[model samples]
Target: MTEPSSTPHATAPGASASSQTAASQSAADETPASQADFRASARRTFAIEEAAIAALESHLDDDFDRACQLMLATKGRVIVTGMGKSGHVASKIAATLASTGTPAFFVHPGEASHGDLGMITPADVVLALSNSGETAEVTALLPLLKRMGTPLVSMTGKPGSTLARDAEAHLDTSVAQEACPLNLAPTASTTAALVMGDALAVALLEARGFTAEEFALSHPGGSLGRRLLLRVQDVMHHGDALPRVALGSPLRDALLEITRQGMGFTCVIDDDDHLVGVYTDGDLRRTLDQHGDLRALKVDDVMTRGGKTVRASMLAAEAVRIMEENRISVLVVCDEDEHPIGAIHMHGLLASGVI
Candidate 1:
């Protein structure tokens, strides 16, 4: 019987992901502007949006400070509301604020006019985004907001418009022109609004002195959370799974321990159960190169004396740094007395998303 060789096909291992992606992209491009230089058009859009965001610096005034102070002093949540494209940017801003220490959530202007207006309170602060500052759905909520005595902070292109005039503070997010050729789409205007929203959230974050650990608490399930919160002991192999052998043990015993634990290395411990050194696969190769008498070799002679170690309480990210700086793939987790309680390998760090 003969095993067939894999041929170069779209789904085969021989066809790499890059090749598949290129094929799909070329096949799926059905643009009407195929004759136009797409990359050059993209560059122009970037330039226009960049100018819009940069223009905001000149527009900053006491209104920006008033907006920040209003949100900071609010006892209840920051209620973010918008319509159409502005709604999408408002949703993201609310999420950023909530995660960064300022509690906030988004409410659609149309929905707010319905029954969701009941969700707002006198202690709450309302952040409204409308490029025209006169969006019917948004402006409809202004009278109710004033009646309830809820402070309004607005980001609008038109400073003289109704929404801006009603707000306690107005952030001018006006842009010179739309990046769209038709000059109707909310291209540069939306970018300016989003950047202004981020400025507000980050300003609030610094005012609150938000810490990374607190940020991790808000995002407890992602790779970022693991990087910020996971300790060396949480990811290291411990107890019986920890690979180790006596310091004076024969090199073959260290080899057996490494193979049994599948850690590619083994800790060498003295009779008092304290780690004295470590023997790795690299050490094995070096030992074989330097010593012809394999039978006479001991772990004590071949091992790296007092090999690099980390405390169990150390951060997993710090452990990764040590591994990178030392050019090693593994580290022994030692106690105050330098006794090996556990071990960590590069594979474990990668698997735990701490790498």
Candidate 2:
């Protein structure tokens, strides 16, 4: 028998390669469109959330004022409570309120029912958060809170919800819709609640006349606290560490004192030990340019008279402000009688983290 003729399936070598090339081309064509769709979705989400937050400005009405007033007048702590995502936001709000001089703390709604309710007292004000206003754990405490005579402030998306109706003051955090594409996840709604909480905290802060110094006291471990709370006396070199020279002391001797103390300047004092002037490296340069003999000049002659001085009780921040405004680095810390008791340099302030 003759050999069978070869079929096209066995004869065509490029057919399999062509099929694979077509498949890869199809996948490559779909990828860019998929990426574009993701970008469009992200933009839409952001726009929706932005509009949601902007709409909140119109909701700031008398209810907001009443909420602020209640918090401001509360003698005891503001008890913040929520469930799920709302609970996380509640904890942050409580921290902001407490740090800004309004006494507040978070108590989980579920925990509240299990004996943590004892944390609530008649004097304390309850700030409850719920997006739906129907959270079972949160709503369960409303009756008990009311029975205890505790003032209830509710933040909810539904104005008609049970929590809102029972609250002494209700803040409407209702959003048009969530940023979630499914409209199920909490996004815009949570952002709105956070912003509203910030508004309340700031309003109360201003109403109470809370100062930066008070804020620093609450945040003692932070850099802001060091800048606001550190005093000149706290960072200044005192006694033997302070570079000092008597009046009519040689300019060279003053320079030696500056070098020995490593403060870049020396305090020139009169016979009574009161600060008369300051001799600094800048003065030394000027003296060197004006005269030929460093031994012939006196510290008082070349020293800048009546140098900028600060009291020991003055805030380090204020001293730094004065230093920047005057364009000088060294500050003579003086007592009530204008006697130089301490010396502070920019380096000292920077080293102590008060700058």
Candidate 3:
């Protein structure tokens, strides 16, 4: 009180400088991590998961063969079941198995207990997944499946767990550690199960002699299916759309036919209506370079003999291969007698989605 100062209750300018510095440091710390840091984290996960898959090679045993034989002998579909993260992987495995000649589908363990168990039968085989081999939801189905007399194949981390002990075949998928920094989340474990599922699918596919055509039958709505199943006859122009000119006809007639059909070429046929040659854009270029007159040329003189051809039964993908290999844009679909029955051009192949 004796010395009331000029700046009473006011802070000295430098007294709280440490606090200002701390605020600045906090703002800088709030900035998001750099991409490099994130990438390093992801790379570590990849390495961990890769090592988990590699470890699977050494763990292979006779149980793998037993599992395959049980599924192969099943008279009904393979019912795949799991819980939580394992359930998601089981769904994909079922899809892969079904697409690769093994009849299979996914049934959630929880749902299976709630009347979905009816989907399973004694003739079917069950493949179950549980990283701990002690998931209550999945384990609960054990007795019911056994009562149904259905064989069980299990993939689990614990070899001595109840599920593993009850299974006809048990695949050990334990990893030394998880990709998770905390080692609590499902990371490497899921990858191991997925890889093991893929192994089973491919093995069954090879054992069953599954062919591409049969695989295409299951996947008939996409470009993959079109490439394998779409045929030349499905995409080629035939009947009244055929562009043809008899051999020895005026070259202008072939040109007009090519222009009318819009396929860039016209078939040159003989009196027997058998394809003898073709007049194409390439032939047109040669003719223009060889002769100046427009009306005096015969179709036979300008036509390329024995033009590239495909059968109506040939796959559109095979047609694409032939076109790419020969550097041609069109192919005549012919009968056994070499009669031009249809025409397929690059545009048609593109439109069919088989190219």
Candidate 4:
């Protein structure tokens, strides 16, 4: 009939529009279900990895101690080496160890076979990582490491693997299941390895008695470094910026000094220029309440004696602690002889990032 219409009847203008609209509605309906599947998948992955890390706690044993002792006693750095995803985890472990007072650095196993092996010395302890323990690049280095007399520490999912057997210490980072739905990805295994690395770093850190100051020295560019290294003298107001008034100076003069220096307080000094007392905004209010005239009072009459003071050489963080303990905002910096040298306000510590 009519040579059979070239276009299918469903492709007619009105039918085509309706069909496209139906397709759009169908896609819109599937979107929420797709999003729900994605979220459920993420939750399952997190749960599996969390369990993997928790399970590692029971695996910590004598080998873990030996690993730490070997690293601690090494005359040289800890050379961390791994391949593939394990290599990424190894690199991070090296960084964490280095920052926490353990000297360490990462070397790729593939590169090690290509002359990077020279980076490892007999004095250094080699920490090798391979989830499979049979990673060709990593297992290839075992004989070389042994020949060099380098002590080897291996982290692997299989305790009986070649890398583990050859290592002086083996850390089992095996997980019960892979977080990947296909059971092919390194998700849970890598998490276990990372947590084990952190455990080693922290154990070594404690054994070495690594103080916050020591940690800060390794991280001089971070906030902890600023808090540990910044001295009171570095942020204190010195010379003319110091608010000081003589012991017998009028209360009015002391208030003027405080306002002039904008330090909220003024140091009342003796004739010898040693700090004798402190007159603050708190003193002014108290004086107004107890006295008839502010001008008639002397700074010594309202000054608080034996006010808290810090040495100029003290850490700004320590100064913050003192201010916090006393519930005050300002502190006068003094010399060894208790002579007022400078003054610090809470704002100074805040600006210096010491608080």
Candidate 5:
């Protein structure tokens, strides 16, 4: 028997299977038109998926709240399981949840029957995905899951399906149709499942009061964590590496400090080791414009007094903001008494992946 056209846009209602096949073949032969068709198909598919997601907005009801609460209250991780395309979606959802402060991991249904089921614990929650809701492998484990006292949340199109009926909570991810021309491939359904997974992850994230710092902790190896949690003191040059000059020091001597530190600037301090002012490359340029005798001028004479500085506790990102706002490339990190302890350059943020 010939299959029904998955799309409503087919040329004619009465078109024979052979005729449809010929048209598809002919269309495929025209390279430019084939590309256009593929683009149009993908665009339509995205629209359908977007619509599927939008449809979920109203469905974010008491069930969603309960799901978030369940996940948050659980002591163990979330175990996501599915078959076929849903397994792919589950893997991504698990990764998203893991990175966003929700402890989660994907468990394939096929693998579960082969002994991976040992991973499930009573403290964990199972998030099962199957469009038909009747996936054999997934359903076969339902009894074991129940025996373990693990709560199940199912995402499926058929609300009456066995998986849905057995689940403690069911999330409807049914799509009206698929983006595939044949309506057989998993397209819109998978999109809906993925979006719902994201929604759940985010809701749980907020309910748990998960902060960016918590998220950063989970992703410490990436640039994101560096930007969000790294401190200026963590990357700033400290100790003897810092270039310092006394207030009475000659400009030529201060220049030697800048050169030895290779920081393009030097801090001018008082006899008490308290920072009095800063002398930078900009100061050197301006001083040169004045045609002053550098050998005779004191460090304080051309220094920029009360320059912008940051605390050691300040985030590196905040330091970047300060630098950008002041139009400067460096900052002197100071103590409570206004004594320079360390220095950081703008490029340091870049090198450390904070920018």
Candidate 6:
């Protein structure tokens, strides 16, 4: 999980600490009759920003389609480059692209000028981000990037700026004005850029028909990957570690097997090694309530017949779901003939990061 850090500079109206200062200043600068003026100013900024983003919906034209096609055809990763705040958004965009299907990585424009440009190659596509379309570090590398025959896709606010004009395709992320009360900081423009990046990534992801399993491949270190990739067989107890009792075994012997395996249940199989039934703690409790001698009864008489089972190849997440739907804690893994192969408990799912 990301560390919980306060949004020191976030412009979220009443949700960010920075807005407190803006609110206090607004209160002091306005009179009773000028309340409407303050509201009108703030409302206008929001309206302008909204209109700017609305404009982008129509601007997602053939250029956007060409950019997606270029990215999909790449034999190498997409190298996202930008300066300042655009660099932060660029890093997130790269991560989103990588997780969705298009492999990508971020290379800071300043770092590129210093020596990191070696990360780019002829097979790679360079995605340059600049709100004003005039960032110095970004513009300086355009000629060199173009010379290498690397296709350029620029996301910028100004369509006529050098970065946009020089790119093979440009995505417009322009905003009418900043959401900043001073109308100077990057607020609306940054949000617009971030949204555009998400739109592009998701569009490509859909076009590629990216699956959840494919997304998990790119995030093998995370919990989602563990849930999707880990199978029931990988976390199940096997051999003597499983609690099992032959048919006609005494209930006491079945209870002993459960205690020995520490799985809270025992499988009862016939002479042929096919599952006959299962004896859980709940079954034991109900059996004991019948006033019969615990040691006198056989597992075949007390076990729950044809209990719930799962296949060894099923995903751990699916196993968790099946267990949940049945209100059970463990499932018997079975083979084609309904013979017990392995057993898994809820705790095993948690241990395997499938919870």
TM-score winner among the candidates?
A: 3
Candidate 1 residue lDDT tens string, 41-144: 99999999999999999999999999999999999999999999999999999999999999999999999887999999999999999999999999999999
Q: Lowest summed lDDT over 10 consecutive residues: which window, candidate 3?
A: 6-15
TM-score of 4: 0.84
Global CA lDDT computed for model 2: 0.92
Lowest summed-lDDT stretch of 10 residues in model 1? 5-14
lDDT of 6 by residue, 166-259 (tens): 9989998887678887878888888888889999899999999999999888888899899889999999998878889999998889988999
- Model 2, 272-331: lDDT tens digits are 999999999898888889998888888878999989999999999899999999999999
Which pairs of residues clash in candidate 1, taking residues 3 or more apart in a chain or in different chains?
Answer: none
**What C-alpha lDDT do the candidate models reach, one value each?**
0.94, 0.92, 0.93, 0.92, 0.89, 0.90
TM match of model 1 to true structure:
0.86
Q: Weakest 10 consecutive residues, lDDT, candidate 6?
A: 8-17
For candidate 5, give the lDDT of residue 57. Answer: 75
**Candidate 4 — what's its lDDT?**
0.92
134 in model 1: Cα distance from truth in Å? 1.4
Most accurate candidate by lDDT? 1
Candidate 1 — what's its lDDT?
Answer: 0.94
TM-score comparison, 2 vs 5, better candidate: 5
lDDT of 3 by residue, 287-354 (tens): 99989996999998879999889999999999999999999999999999999999998888998788
List residue ranges in candidate 4 displaced over 4 A. 1-26, 32-39, 285-298
lDDT of 5 by residue, 264-335 (tens): 999999989898899999999999999656777888888999898899999999999999998999999999
Better of 3 and 4 by TM-score: 3
- Per-residue lDDT of 179 in model 4: 97
